[model samples]
Target: MQEWWRSAVIYQVYPRSYQDSDGDGIGDLAGITSRLDHIAALGVDCIWLSPIFASPQADMGYDVSDYLAVDPIFGNLAAFDTLITEAHARGLKVITDQVLSHTSDKHEWFQQSRKDRDNDKADWYVWADPLPDGSPPTNWHSHFGGPAWEFDPGRGQYYLHHFLASQPDLNYHNPDVVDAILETCKFWLDRGLDGFRLDTVNYFFHDHELRSNPPAQTRPQVMATDLYGMQKNIYNKTRPENLGFLERLRTLTNQYKDIMMVGEVGEMGNRSIEIMGEYTAGEHRLHMAYSFAMLGPDFNAEHFRNCIEGFQRGAPDGHPYWSFSNHDVPRQVSRWAEHSVSEDAMARLSCAMLMSFEGTIGIYQGEELGQTETEMEFEELTDPPAIRYWPNVKGRDGCRTPMVWEKDQPNAGFSTGKPWLPVKAPQAAKAVDQQTDDGIMAFYKEMIAYRKNSPVLSRGKTTFIDQPEPILAFTRKADAEAMTFVFNLSKDTQEIPMQAEAEIAKGNFAQIKDGTLTLEGNGYVYLSHTGKAPI
Candidate 1:
């Protein structure tokens, strides 16, 4: 089978926020199955569903208790099978989030591991002896807050947990543990899953010596609400032993024809790009990897250029998947509001910019509708991080609100009952029911189609042209086909020297005359230099 993921576009669906068929105020598999046509119509090749495995809902299904079973809230195994069949029938491959770095403390393995040190599962989790003062094993801190080590009274030691105490990090140092993890993956592949999106792929290992990480010069990807980034995390994650486990996983996936795995590199800043390269540098590793580099607050052309160029310079043969918005971060339109003329313009510009990049593309649910972050009160917050650090952190509940499908219905037609997270007026106003022919949703459809049909944009090599700030220019070429893409990532009109001029194949708010390319605020243009123009 061909590497279908090399040029595929994946639509990410946060199942809990998508639809609720059982009126339980939470989205489920049946609800997602009912909405297959909506995803198929988006012109994307694959569907990436967030974690739906049997979890205790401690961290919204990411804290898994059973890797092989579907949670009751999402549906049973039979419902998942039906969803796979429906999605495949529509020529769409299905992938699910695999949270392998940790498991819920309620899991049988963890439960047994904590019972006695002589059990078969005793070494299944990362446990260490407390320091001289009976404190945590090290100076490590959890991504949520406080110490990364949680003391278990029965075990007489501290077990490592990168997130909440409910979610305990697995011990990849044990080969038996790796074997067990691969079996769960084999079970999913046998059920006809096309691929997997590995959540926090780089977090699968830790230094066994328990060396304390040094302090950092700059905490790039942290907020003041957490102290996890106060020191550079060298010992806790990104261990060299991680490659062996990834290779073992790749070997397992290779057994099933056409199965691919895209990992989520759990890092930030330029270092994230370097890790992405290493993880996807060879065929024996991940098929592709993505990080939170582009998901942050940077909106300038230099930042975008450096990210793309850094990935290329780090690993020439590696592959990357770029995304603008997801459940964890604020929406792109709302996050970069100061750089665009309006919400609609920013949405359109983001779509055009993301599609023009060279790699597999992912768009989160409701992003096509230009959905902004839903402001939530402390009482309405359920995310563990936000609830713990209320006023300062302002948790991720705002980004994880339910998707809006109707304008005037209760809960915006997302649910007959009150949603898990309230769907306010600002979000409901951009409902699917109220979309116009030239609306943001339509532009997403157009831009996605434009990318799907263009080989240069998908399979071509990129060469960026140096320009001033807020002016991003690049050329993609494959065979006789070539195209130049330029975007004015600012609120003011700007002009640049036209490197090459062709017909405006697809895009808006730009013009070309007298060797000058003029772009209005948030303007973009697709200059096709080949006979085969964009659709």
Candidate 2:
């Protein structure tokens, strides 16, 4: 089968916010099917839907109660079939989110497992004996805001939950659990689904010994809200066993044609890249992997360079999926506001930079429209993290706001009724209908077209140029075609001396005059060159 995903641009759709066909203040599969034209117009090759599986809505469908069934809130199996068909018709592959790491406490397997220690499904989840004093298990901490272990009086044991207490981590140590998950994957594949976006892929397994993770050498003050980050996270997740499970997943996916699996490496710093490398090292593992490395607050040349370079050095054969914004984090336009001249400039620059990178690219919904994160009051929030952390964390609700389609329509045309998340003035201002001739949207369409036309940007090898602060420069060289990409990541104008036999692309922002390249604030340029000197 062809490795189509290698250069494919994936558009991530957060179901609850994309479009709501019904007036339930939520988005559904049918709503997504209706908006397929917008995604098709953006020239994306695939659509990665966030979790829409049956759930108790504890973690917004991340807590899966039924892996094979679609949540009623997002329509049923019939609706999902229609979505797959419509997406395929638009020449776009459909990849749904697969939260394999854990399931909702309301799931039948979990219900059974928690009923009794000697039940048939007793080992279906990660259950451990409490300490002698009746305290919970080891020092493992949940990513949400509490201990990783949740006590169940019925089973008289503590169950491991990397996220919410309601979202219990499955025991991958059991072969049955692995087999069952594979079967669930097969169910979707049989339904004409292209592939899956494995959620928190690194957290699939935990140390059998139940060992406590050691403290990190240094805890960054930036992520202080997440106490889980204070530790090295050695024993809790990204265990060696994950590779075997991934291989098993790869083996299963191999049975299908052109099927791909992109695992989400939910780690930070160099370790995240390392895990991405390991998980995608070869054909036997994941087709590609992505991490939160670029989703953080750091917005500099060195940071971006390190992430791409680190992946290349760590896993030369491994593939990577890069995205600046997603459902979990704040919008890039808002997150990188300090470095941006304006939100529009940042949006255009982001597209230029992400498309020029040599890997699979992902664009979250509303990004093409230059949507900024919506500010919401405490009562307006739906995300658990935001509700718990409140003022300090402000969780993912801002980014997960409704997709604004029309400025005049109700709820920005996302829904006829009230939206689950508010569409405030800042976000509604960039509505799709209003942005027909918008610079950011036009740049996105043009840049995506440019990227698809040039194989070098997608398949070439990346070579970074050592330049001063604020300027990021790199050359992407394929067999015969080579292109140099330069960006001013800061709000200040910068000029760099470049000696190259290159012609500037017409639609690009920056220009080269008198052998000197000048980049305005948040400006970027693409240079096509057959021969090159210093870049």
Tens digits of lDDT, candidate 1, 1-535: 4488988989999999999998989999999999999999988999999999999998999999999999999999999999999999999999999999999999999999999899999999999998999998789889888899999999899999999999999999998899999999999999999989999999999999999988886755457545777789989999999889999999999998898899998898899999999999979999999999999999999999989999999879999899998989999999999898999889988999999999899999999899999899999999998998778888888989998999899999999987899999999999999999989888888888888788897798998977788888888998889998889899999987654447888777888778877889999998888643221
Give the Cα lDDT of each candidate.
0.91, 0.90
On a 0 to 100 scale, what is the lDDT of residue 495 in model 2? Answer: 84
**Per-residue alpha-carbon lDDT of candidate 2 for residues 1-535, written as tens digits (9 for 90 to 100):** 4488999999999999999999899999999999999999999999999999999998899999999999999999999999998888889999999999999999999989988989889999999989999987789888888799998999889999988999999999999999999999999999998999999999998999998889876985455357887788999998999999999989998999999999999898888998899999978999999999999999999999999999999999999999999999999999999999887889888888999998999999999999898888999988887788878878889999999999988999999888888888878888888886656787788888888888787688999988988888898898998888888998888888878667777324577788888888998888888887347
Which consecutive 10 residues in model 2 have the weakest lDDT in total? 500-509
Could you tell me how far off, in angstroms, the CA of residue 53 lies in candidate 1 after the best superposition?
0.9
Q: Candidate 2: where is the Cα deviation over 4 Å?
A: 220-224, 506-509
Between which residue pairs do clashes occur in model 2? none
In terms of lDDT, model 2 sits at 0.90
